[model samples]
Target: MNKRFYIIFTVILVIYFILKYLSGFYIDFEWFRQNNGLSVFWVLFMTKFNVQAMFGTIFIVLFLLNFLMIRILGGKGRFFAENFLDRINIPAIGSSRKLLLLIVTAVVIFTGFVMGGGASAFWKEYLMFKNSVPFTGFPADPVFGRDPGFYVFSLPFYKFLYGWFMSTLVIITIFTVLLHVLNGAIQKTVRGVDLSPFSRAHISIMLAMMVILYGLSYQLAAYELLFSQIGKFYGAGYTAVNANLLAYRAAEVISFIAGALLIFNVFKRSFKLPVIVMLTLIPVYFILGVIYPALQQRFIVVPNELGKETPYIQNNINFTRLAYGIDRVEEIPFANKRELTYADILKNRETLESVRLWDWRPLKQTYKQLQELKQYYYFNDVDVDRYVINGKKIAVNLSARELTIENLGVNSQTWQNQHLIYTHGYGLVMSRVDRITSEGLPVLIIKDIPPV
Candidate 1:
């Protein structure tokens, strides 16, 4: 609305564009190739435009809506705004100089604590990922070994923290502003009334409860799913697991009830029943919901698992085989003997011919050169697997993964592009390893799934 504000905004836009160009240039530089960690910071900084745009849009819409609402409400709204601003200024808090100093001090202290904690956690995990000895697990590709090309070359952990920090700060700030607006609106509507729907204490408690609920939601959801899956497979020693799951669910239900009661009390200004319930539930939750289950699992479940190892082993084998599609293979049991026969070789020719010897690293490069349809469609890695085709076992090379729109280019990663236009990647590109087309491309065996 002012010339100074416009000047500052324009300067920020120019600086951001300059930095964006620099980041892209640096990514292609040989220096960046040698020092990948430096690129992480620049990439994270350049990629923050979308998040900034989102929060900026939210702030602008809220400001406009507040202005329109006040205009509709007439003189009362103007008077309320004036009174609110007046009350916000602390009485006899000394001169403007002192007030500015105090504000600066408070900001420094607050940011120091917040940023210190974030940096500590970030560096701890960064070092862990950086110095980690690669091992076989969910995140590791078994065929290619532990270190996937993506994990080895990219600073995913740093990028994740950067995104999390930016999004959390933006969301929290937006919600805080919205909450302030709502409080002011309520106060304006109930002019001169003693009873308010939301007191400062009530808002503070609710905010704290929200953070707790966010953490509990993830914890409870993960454990609930784990126990449910375990119950489906291992029915023998699942009673303790079931009891532990029930305890967790019960705790979650009680926590939700407590939060609801707190909200209800905020509006009704009721007696301290909600406070009493919350206080009581905390201990009850600790005892019945946490301790009891742990004790039961330790005493009953451990002994039972030890005694009945065969069933548990069978369940594990069944689940693992099913998960990896090992059970789908045609199994033909044969007697072991000191023998070397052409008959055995003939019988197992299908399996022998399906053995993959082509290195994936070079194959990935070849696929990128020949198969990539567009800039967005990336061929990151090659996977080799044997499949029964027309009653014959054949090995196939494919890359099922595709880069997200955000990874395609910054310009193509608008809100609609990310959230709507292309929410997920296209399907796999597959071909027989030993075959080539006339144009020197891998023989197209199975193209994109869903036909497009």
Candidate 2:
């Protein structure tokens, strides 16, 4: 078993590396680039170089190493068939199943709350957005309200719930398996404490539950992903819109029902109903969630483009304008006089003086050398804005886009820096464009002073 495991692991690693390299080549291909337009391939390529992927890779490797170490320690010659093979009924940790369920439920909810930034942040942001909006009606947003506070709040909760369910299921299943494996190995090594082996029924049920939960999680994730793309579906015409909506909504409903059934089966300690549901529902899901949508797009949407696309186009226009606050901007026709007077040039002297002659690259470097007080807070860009200073409107060059501690690379970002120390940005460095001090530095109008 050890040898087989080693061989399989090595083969999988080799295949993974080969595919990883091949993916690089595939992404660089012109046809692939044109067809995909920076899709999952791009995301994978970028993620490979990130800290999260590094940590994830390290974790998997560690788990594999642990398995190898355990196998090596428990030599084949020391194996006792009677002790290892005999099925033992291990009772629940708690007094009753209900107690176990309650503990699990609490843990899952706590995990969700922590991972989702707690209820305080959610409600605070929701209320802040609701109060900030000037007006509320259909023009502001068609579905939810003027602001997307409800949608935004609900999105994180949805993610949290899904993550909690999947993670809890995975942890429990892995713990059960690991407990059995470790118990066997311990029994072989130490002779003092007698430990019960996992019963066949318990093992089978745990494995089945894990598999069912995994499948349900994956299907639900697909539903979530599809549903989230509703905003991007606006311009795709009525048929395409209808098809995608139907597909995602149907997937979500079915996935929810299937998930509920699985939970029911878990409590009942029988996989019959859940198995039947999975077998029946998956094919129907494939048809409605995949095939029907494709057929609708290919036949109905693509053919009647001019006729069917008008309403969708209007929706896209209206929603986009509302979302972006573009409808509020007044548009006036401009008739260029085609004449510039001396008075006009004098009137716009501040703007003309602000026309930057110095290259931003050198200016940024100089600003960093002279102005940047902290190492973490560095200037990213140099901007020019007109400010009223000392009863005179003057164009001032500034470096306001500071890279705060939170803006540092992912490896450097900590919870403390992200949430506490770096809640807001450092103040800007503003200097008059025309004025220069004796030391050849631009005269500082506004230095490291944050907004009042």
Candidate 3:
């Protein structure tokens, strides 16, 4: 019987591990390499909501409860062990079921390591991404803060076992192993206690009930809601992964509570006071920890492009800050869609140009704004800076070198200075550059401008 259980556990673990490595596990690392930082929430969700989430959650909780129950009852003078077994006159587990469970769990975990593609392309990519410098999209800091008491709740045990990623796979794998041990112990305890068929049935039904509740709490309900929320908001890409880390922390709390509750339910006869207190206090603590962050105000970056000198809001908007009045979200424009093209190409490149070199900027300029004037204004021949239409060769005087409607008018696109832009069609070549050649503005028609 023990050997059969071991085989079943091993098969399940191996299948899951292989799935983990194949499902783009290393993309997280690739993201960190390109983006310059890791978002733990993102990776957790992707791994958790997989098919394994369903089976793994339920099995682990019941398995652990079985172990603790055996340990408490197996001891001399334990209430349930003394009361129930005394009345039934049945043999409790003569041998340790916990040990059998441990063996099965070990086999399953070993399979996970072996079948999960022993460090292939995914591993390599993850390593590269982690080693590279992190990328920051915004010009400011963007990592979310963690709760201080998180480590307090997750202290010496769970942390020591998993070593940090705190993923569902690791959680499931760990709890599953523990469950096997407890399940074996409980079976042994029943045999030693000498319970009847009816009692056995009663126990089995109760165990099943606990399993279902724990499953819903640990795997299905808590973590799924959080991860699903993240996926819906963040989009299914590496850039939007930070949301998953928050969900993982929430899931961890659920696991801890479910484990506690299972033990309390099994040993309802003795230690009832302590169990009740733990049940009440622990849940309240976890609930507060989860809610505090959501209540506090957070900084969010909102980006858009519109007409303005600088569109970035330069203040923090928090709960207290809101009382004084402030925009909830700040907007910053990354780029402008405005286009800049040359004005005139007709009477040499120097003769054709726009009224201003760069007019896309909101700054307005007039002819009087020129501090210095020059008859012959030269531009960066290699890099076209500015152009002159009627100015002659002379030194710049002053007045910031401005211009007016009298000195310059819109040039004709089809002027004589325009190049013959040819188009070969039906044995005819059309001049495509004529409009743009003389006057820089392609939109201007030859008839619109007065003849020079």
Compared with the true structure, all predictions reach lDDT values of: 0.54, 0.55, 0.34
Tens-digit lDDT track of model 3 for 1-452: 45666578779977887788657657756767578555653554343443233334333444445445444543432223233223332123223444444554564445333323222213333333334442222222122222322222322223222222233344443544344233332233644533322223324334334433433333322222322322113211111223233444554465455445544544453333334543664565455444432332122211211111021111122322443444355777889776555443344553332232323221112221221133222111111122232463311111111222222234533443233421111111111122333434322111111211
TM-score of 2: 0.37
**Which residue window of length 10 is worst by lDDT in model 2?**
193-202
Candidate numbers sorted by lDDT from highest down: 2, 1, 3
> Which residue pairs come into collision in candidate 1?
none
- Evaluated against the true structure, the overall lDDT of model 2 is 0.55
Number of the candidate with higher lDDT, 1 or 3: 1
Predicted structure 3: lDDT: 0.34
Top candidate by lDDT: 2
TM-score per prediction, in order, is 0.38, 0.37, 0.26
Clashing pairs in 2: none
Clashes of each: 0, 0, 46
lDDT of 1 by residue, 1-452 (tens): 54466468768976996798678766656465677666665554444443344434443453344334333442332223433433454345544434544543444344434444344444434545656654344334321223443344334454545454444444444444443443353343543432123333344344435534633553334333332333335332344345555666677666676766666665565435555765777687778556886677676666775553455456557656765878889979897876868998899876666655446787788767755666777876788887787887789988864764645577776888777777666777777766656766666666654533
